[model samples]
Target: MKNNENSDIHLVINIAQQTLILYQHNKKMAQYAVSTAKNGIGSQQDSGCTPLGKHFIAKKIGASEPINTVFIGRVPTGEIYEAKLGMLHPERDWILSRILWLGGVEEGLNKGSNSEGGCDTYQRYIYIHGTPDSEPMGEPLSHGCIRMRNEDIIKLFDQVEAGTSVVIIAH
Candidate 1:
């Protein structure tokens, strides 16, 4: 992405508050309640926990799709998420609305490592995406990804572009 592409907007996810703040030109544009990982905060593969520190929107998916559109591996499945679909697959980790695939900015902290303590968040496939309406927000309930409501994620996806800076803070 060009340097100017995301210069005007950025995102900050506060784990403690379970909220994501959108900033444009360094001013708060919007805030949305979110759900983080249920396993808590950590930088480890298979931990099912949210990783901390600075990151960026590595990729943006599901543009032009309707709300509740289902995505698998960032590819639209052509299926819109509804209540019955969720009930049929109760064990599924629904990735709906839009996907803001995240890549870590710091090495050895939240990115880059295939060894004992090197857990790359990008490699972890961590994303900010939408979940079922029946799901609760403002809580730690996801499986490592940051979950948002359908309406909120759609709104956010329209406002931000790829490469936008994203900071996740534990406090």
Candidate 2:
């Protein structure tokens, strides 16, 4: 992405507050409640935790998909999420609406592995995405990704593009 593409807007996810704040030109534009990893924060593969540090939106998906549209492997599953469907598949980790696929920028912390124990955020498929309405927000409940409400995700997706900067902070 060009350097100017995301110079005006950025995102900050505060794990402690369980909130995602959107900033444009260094001013707060919006804030939304979010759910981080239930397992807490880590950068190792399969750790089921949210990785910290600097990241950028590597991909923007589901541009025109309807809210509650299900996604598997970042591909639309053609299934709209609802109460009945969620009940039918109790074990499914629902990735709904849009996806802001994140790629770490700080090497060894989140971008790439290093001697001190690190992993790739993109490789781990870490994303800021939609979750079912039934799920709780402002809490640590997701497997790893930052989970937002379906409507909130859609709103965010429309406002940002690939290459937008994001920062995840433990405090």
Candidate 3:
């Protein structure tokens, strides 16, 4: 492991600041600008908003893929992202590089069936993944996931495991 194996590692994203911090044993290891949801924060199913409270990485995908590699349905699309690619398909929601698929930790809140409200973030297909280089960071501009730069998502994907804790906060 590149990080201290025994140190408790967790990730915290402050929606208000549009930043994410990697913490080890309560000490900040790194900080990066991130883009949350353009629709803002909420837990309703199909809300297209970022969910609040606790979560964990349920799945990690694309460990060896090149940066800017495109993903569809959480599978790499066998194509790398370029400006021309976006121009060709102007409506695709880009999921690139690596993915840390999030699952809700709070019961009946961020996690169950969509009927009552929100069930699981996993069911919602929420992830922290890379976006196009042209997309501005530190802004509320993503559909409903945490969006990072291709380089940053690659770095983060290497540092955390499937069960690592994550907390999303508004401020």
Candidate 4:
């Protein structure tokens, strides 16, 4: 990751290309392949799908935890991720490494339009987090949150903080 004197990092996620771009201020720093929701994209509360449009890192979790540690609901489970262990829990969502919790910036689309009903975006609990090593990285495979490799997630976790601007653009 490239360091800049800028106060915030700009993040762009492309679902079609399965890539995440990190920019310090306006300068490109790093780009890594990612896996998004298997159900495709949309910005809806309780959709169990990836949201598009503008979002922000509402919360940051797992700061000093070791890589490949298992996390459930953004809290480390104290069990390290292992291939055999993963095979045991074949159905686990498997949030590993770090978590960058995302909350929708667009009120209507994500937070719910007044025409629809009042819904809380933050309660939806969308995030960009790490997945098990056995999982495919450059494909759409998550329930909703974006999934990245352990190393990539850790690197990204260090570069950005809570409230960092994250833009999800569909191709």
Candidate 5:
């Protein structure tokens, strides 16, 4: 890995392709298939839809937590997540491995409704997080956050730090 002292990574989520691309100073570092919100991608506060446009990693959660460990409120629940467990709690939104909390940088797009008559979406707690192993990726299937495989998220978590730039492009 070429760790340039100034190597800054950019995470771009393409809603149409259901893919997340990691770039190091405009050069593609890696790309991973992702699963977005089932309701589709949008940026309205509390709309239960993934926000679009420029954002930053406001927080990085689950740094060394074991894979499959359940997380609620960004803290490990001390319970190892299993596919069967998910089946029992079918309504659960499984957030495992790591979490990249996103904050909207655009004013009305995500930060909140603009004074000039636009919607605000940042008040909503949005994230890109790990999902159960059995969950299908490359498909829309989340409340509002982006989902990735546990292993893939772990790898990504290791590569990124807080304040990383993330952009979610609408489909």
Candidate 6:
């Protein structure tokens, strides 16, 4: 295998600054603006808040798909996002381009129950995915996922793989 494919890759999502940094072999590769949950951070299920702590890319979805392709339930919906289409579905939480589903590695904090209900990141369907181009970046405005630009998500998707380590921090 090529060295690039075998190198260690890690992601650090900073909620406070609303940015996601990509690190390869302990060196910074790229950084992208992101929008975290509007409700801020938490681990409880149904909180509609982004879970914080150690995580990993459990699944990488929408490879080779066209940019702006809409996804629902992690499945491509055969519709490419456009301004007109966005206007037609104003209530939709658009998951476009690509998706990097996250699974929390920290138990009782983000992986499992925490004296309350379930806190599993995978179960909660937390992801670093693309949003509509109209949506503002570097702002807390998502339901629970980390929202990125369509092109940016595609770029990030190509550089990382499933099981890549991630750490989401408040600051």
Q: How close is candidate 5 to the true structure, as a TM-score?
A: 0.89
User: Mind giving the per-residue lDDT tens digits that candidate 2 earns over 65-146?
Assistant: 9999999999999999999999999999999999999998888889778775558899999999999999999999999999
- Writing each residue's lDDT as its tens digit, candidate 4 over 60-170 gives 889999999888867888999999998888888889989888777677766655465543346677789888877898899998889999999999999887778888899
Q: lDDT of each model, Cα atoms only?
A: 0.90, 0.92, 0.90, 0.82, 0.82, 0.91
Assess candidate 6 and give its TM-score to the true structure: 0.95
Candidate 2 Cα misplacement greater than 4 A, ranges: 1-6, 116-118
Tens-digit per-residue lDDT, 79-122, candidate 6: 99999999999999999999999988778998878789799999
Those runs of model 3 whose alpha carbons end farther than 4 Å from true positions after fitting are 1-7
**What is candidate 1's lDDT per residue for 74-98, written digit by digit as tens?**
8999999998998888888999989
Worst 10 residues of 3 by lDDT: 1-10
TM-score for candidate 2, please give it.
0.95
How far residue 26's Cα lies from its native spot in candidate 3, in Å, is 1.0
lDDT of 5 by residue, 5-110 (tens): 2437888999989999999879999999999989886776556778788888878888878888899888898988997789899888889888888877777777
Q: Across residues 48-158, which tens digit of lDDT does each residue of candidate 3 receive?
A: 899998888889999999999999998998999999999999999999999999988777777875556656788899999999999999989998899999999999999
Residue 51, model 3: lDDT of: 90
Ranking of candidates on lDDT, top first: 2, 6, 1, 3, 4, 5
Candidate 6 Cα lDDT to native? 0.91
Poorest 10 consecutive residues of model 5 by lDDT? 1-10
Question: Candidate 2, residue 128: CA error in Å?
Answer: 0.4
TM accuracy, model 3 = 0.93
Clashing pairs in 3: 111-119, 112-119
Off by over 4 Å in 6: 1-7
Each candidate's clash count: 0, 0, 2, 0, 3, 0
